[model samples]
Target: MRPGERAVLLGPGEIGEPTVDDWAAWSDTLPHEVVTGLGARLHRHLRPAATTTLRSL
Candidate 1:
């Protein structure tokens, strides 16, 4: 994705406890060039608004 492109994550309560092995596993399953952590606090703060804005954009 481009520099300004927006992304959101969905999972089964694993966002806060992500590890190196989690990333490595994601790398194999995701189609993107990279897969990185989105800390729980930031994810929680932005999830609602970000989803709306991203859809409109």
Candidate 2:
């Protein structure tokens, strides 16, 4: 949203060291356009759900 700002993609594994193959396989299943769209809207998609006492991990 600002100049020089950047985004990082991490997941499919633990905090310290995330696995790469899992994410690669999953991405391969989706179209390039869809993946690009998700990258742009990643914040909205990862937002916490409302009305939750303690949501499942």
Candidate 3:
């Protein structure tokens, strides 16, 4: 999604906003080292997806 755009995940039921503890729990479910490595790879892969917008004065 673009900046300021809203996104919703459609599943069997509505997913509510996550709390700090919820995030902590979710993080605990994943392998931290693997997740961190994947994050770095994803960042490298998606970095070029960012673009700059120009406005005329």
Candidate 4:
């Protein structure tokens, strides 16, 4: 590990968008202390696509 560097795990979702369950499962595999320290902000960069009203309209 390097200074100011964090570890990231790519989830099974397309484009790496981890669902709530996926995130929970991944966190469950890690040590309690590690998960606690990292907090919810972990992997915050990944996001699901937003919906638009005009889609399929």
Candidate whose lDDT is highest: 4
Candidate 1 minimal-lDDT segment of 10 residues: 48-57
- Evaluation by lDDT, superior candidate among 1 and 2: 2
Q: Which stretches of candidate 1 lie over 4 Å from their true place?
A: 1-15, 29-57
Give model 2's clash tally.
Answer: 0
Give the poorly placed runs of model 4, Cα more than 4 Å off: 1-16, 29-57
In model 1, what lDDT does residue 18 have? 52
What TM-score does model 3 achieve against the real structure?
A: 0.27
| Candidate 4: C-alpha lDDT | 0.55
Q: Give one digit per residue, the lDDT tens place, for model 3 in 1-57.
A: 789565432111225744333444666753344335444433232223144657464
Candidate 3 stretches greater than 4 Å from native: 6-15, 29-57
For candidate 4, the C-alpha RMSD (Å) to the true structure equals: 8.5
lDDT of 2 at 38: 52
Candidate 2: where are CA atoms >4 Å away?
A: 1-12, 15-20, 29-37, 44-57
lDDT of each: 0.44, 0.48, 0.40, 0.55
What is the C-alpha RMSD, rounded to one decimal, of candidate 3?
Answer: 13.3
Using TM-score as the measure, which candidate wins? 3
Give me the displacement of residue 25 in model 4, in angstroms.
Answer: 0.3
Q: Is candidate 1 or candidate 4 better by TM-score?
A: 4
Better of 2 and 3 by lDDT: 2
lDDT of 1: 0.44
Over all chains combined, what TM-score does candidate 2 have?
0.22
